[model samples]
Target: MGSVVEHKRTDKRTGKTVTQYRAHIRRVGFGSRSKVFATKREALDWIRNNESDNALTKRASAGGKTLASLIEDFIAAGVCQYASQAHLAYWCDQLGNKLVSEITHGDINGALLSLRTRGGRRFTPDGIKPSGKPLTPATINRYAAALSAVFNFAQAHGVIDAHPMKGGKVKKLKEGPGRQRILTPEEETRLLETARAARWDGMYLFVLMLLTTAARKSEVLNLRWRDLDLGRGIAVLGKTKNGAARALPLVAEVRKGLAELSKVRPINSDFVFYDPKQPGRPKNVDTAWQFVRERAGLNDSDDPVHRVVLHTTRHTGVTKIIRNGANLAQAALISGHKTLAMLKRYEHLAADDVLQLAEHALGKVGTGSSKG
Candidate 1:
């Protein structure tokens, strides 16, 4: 009930011909399945394993459940992480109509490939638009992982018998280094001045807190009066991206700004950046941020890494911390980076700083000339 077909194709990267095997399996009362493999042995092995598993689970019917329904059930189970919900919802939009049994490795793989090449839909001023840039390898992998979680949940609940993406059937793409952009002194000054003049009252304080505390945009925007301690010059982030609580040190300028902001705080809301129109919600700062960045000339660069965004302030803060004599561990404590590896991207030093450090350590070292 299975077959392996050999095919030859030119490798796009190497321009050399290579052989590939496509394994196909079909059993009574089961949908057809196929997967491509790099070697004949692999193809044969896949066919055998699938046939054996199908025989044992012949009574199970994954056909009754659609992927969309399964995704809804998975979401209802409360197992998905907050960040992964969007990615899982995307899979629902793509393959939701298909029955769980009809889904295959090739389907998932092709969808991921398309996601990498074509990017995803994004919201803009005009309306929904396709992203201008392709999703990075890391992003693609995240999408795949999120969908895989749905499949795993289905299998655990007896909604599906097998996972198409199991056992590393879908290989992850190699990810490059993370972005390391930091603002120059001139850029920082221009951004602050523009933010100070911004019509949005919270813009200046938000940007200042981002730079001084190295807090993420979400963290700063979600701040409440209870989270701040101006007397101790500290702000506690009770919830963070890494699921850990961390404290951010508020400098004199940041403390003074907050003190002023508190005086004008709305009597109705507790949020630091509460929307005036809807005091229950945080202010939508995206439009105001875009305006400020464009006015300050920070958005002139087309390169995403070089283009200044809210997160760029965090990078600038961490770099400045390191430049001002703080080691990686010390910087991590201030920036709330969960690990040194995650914080390593901000370990940038100027050539002048490196030269001075070298001079300071080896200025009086003597050569072995014996004075002869």
Candidate 2:
């Protein structure tokens, strides 16, 4: 609803009275707007124009948004994880120009299928190049899950009446078994020795923490001094991929390495792995890690199944814990794995070890029967 009111005021310079018309509008779900005009007709005209535009805007927002715009809003809301944000950004590049209402199940399915052959983008000295390897079903599912989140956000916000991914319009592909790569004793020894001699003084400590703590690369890099309690020999991860805080136990060797590194810690920063150039930020050790891995002869092949990467350190740590007689629950606590299913992948054991355990248990029963 709207109304127009007339007012009279004395002009200070001319010492004359002037009249003006003020038009005011108040509508539900909209902010009130008022404007003054010299003539009542002009005031009424402005109100009519604004009201008409407002009605049109309301109608358009219901179904006229582009996928990119909705993605922008979703990002602004800051509800998704960091990894999902990257996936969503990739979607913005793929379907940004398309209208939300026009997107169909086929469109999404086709996009995911295309990802299989297209592979992941990799940066090389020559520029961006496709990895040439087809994306695994698990990787493809991650992309699908990211897109599903956006559609879910749109539905909750009333931007769309129905979910495009609903009713299993797009299904998750079956993922292969998880990687079971673990560092052999010789490889672990060689890796640590190489890291100790690397030019980057922090390399040894960083690798040691990863191998000992079973923490992710990002989690280790983001570690701060305050997060550590040297007396307790534990590191508190305040933020993790699972959005839960967990504590990582520090071994005697790790505690010694950290103690030595803290002696050279910069006074201006709290980050344990603070960048030399930017004291306020954590150091990116990708190049350093690559150098150490190559020098250690760990990068002999491009095979993902056997390739030793940063994440392999986590896998190694968890695998070693299970091999050393720790159960799945104990390993999950150290690895910060939220589910036992995810932790099960690292439960690899040697055939000899399994046989020995079976013999040890049955041997006692056989001895008792012989005595009887």
Candidate 3:
């Protein structure tokens, strides 16, 4: 059983009185449902759906398990523990009490669409700001993947007969080539100088380490004194996004910086990079990084067109690795990328570099290879 309530409120944008509808549903043992809608019809419609789902659950608890219980089991399984926990939580918050076996493709798609449109920073100083940027295909795909993992796990454990996301019922968006914003030598110089100007010792070294090893931000931030084998010029990374401990070779520039820091190191803290404000913990570079990025003129757009940011250092480093004569396989090994396809995606070719490759294919003729 459910009821809809109508209330009048002033619109933030229009500055006019408007009617808002709030629907409430109360079900024994399954808990209560409530949602606000712009129209009474919409509110009533949602109430009807809740009544239907609740009725179905009472009939037999759809395959003897609810989505809410599945989430608890899935969390115990720890498949998407950190990297994608929030994405999974978003789905669970909405659909948790529903039966996994009864959850349809439409259910998942509708939630994704609502998330894209309705997720906004409301009541800001500038009033309601529509998320200026629409979600990218890559981002949407990641959300799909997180949900897919949960359903797959549920099916594998015999909780469901089949998963809706499987067999192309819900298709992912066709993503474009990954972002590639390799820095020029001048830009690199300016960025390093700007980091120094920011006056965070960790920022300068971290920037150098990123350019040198092509390590992810979290990878470098987790580094400790014992993690470095400076004499051998390699770093052993115990914790990584992929859950595999691997080694990243230290380039001369990074080695030089690390060597300088090692002499003045504090024995009290084992962390290689520390916040001067807190010596025991890993350095908090966010504020210093913001300053450095602005000073270095970094763009913060995820427009999928192209932009440079701290993470762009990985793209830049990988491009330089391949340009400096590392083959695709070698580049993958160095950057710890699992596949050649991923390695190639990180290798952004400059227009001039492509022209040179064309020139090389055509063969070098007179006086250092130029035609007048």
lDDT per residue, candidate 2, 101-206, as tens digits? 6788999988887888778876565776887788888888998888888888888887765677888899999987656567888998899999999887889989
lDDT of each: 0.82, 0.83, 0.77
Residue runs of model 1 more than 4 Å from their true location after superposition: 1-86, 98-104, 148-166, 349-352, 363-365, 368-372
| lDDT tens digits by residue: candidate 1, 281-324 | 89888889999999998887767667678888988888888889
Over 303-322, each residue of candidate 3 has an lDDT whose tens digit, in order, gives 55577767888888888888
Residue-level lDDT for 58 in candidate 1: 51
Which one wins by lDDT: 1 or 3? 1
Query: In lDDT terms, how accurate is model 1?
Result: 0.82
Compute each candidate's TM-score over C-alphas. Answer: 0.73, 0.75, 0.69
Clashes of 1: 0
Off by over 4 Å in 2: 1-59, 62-64, 82-86, 125-127, 266-270, 349-352, 363-372
TM-score for candidate 2, please give it: 0.75
User: Against the true structure, whose lDDT is highest?
Assistant: 2
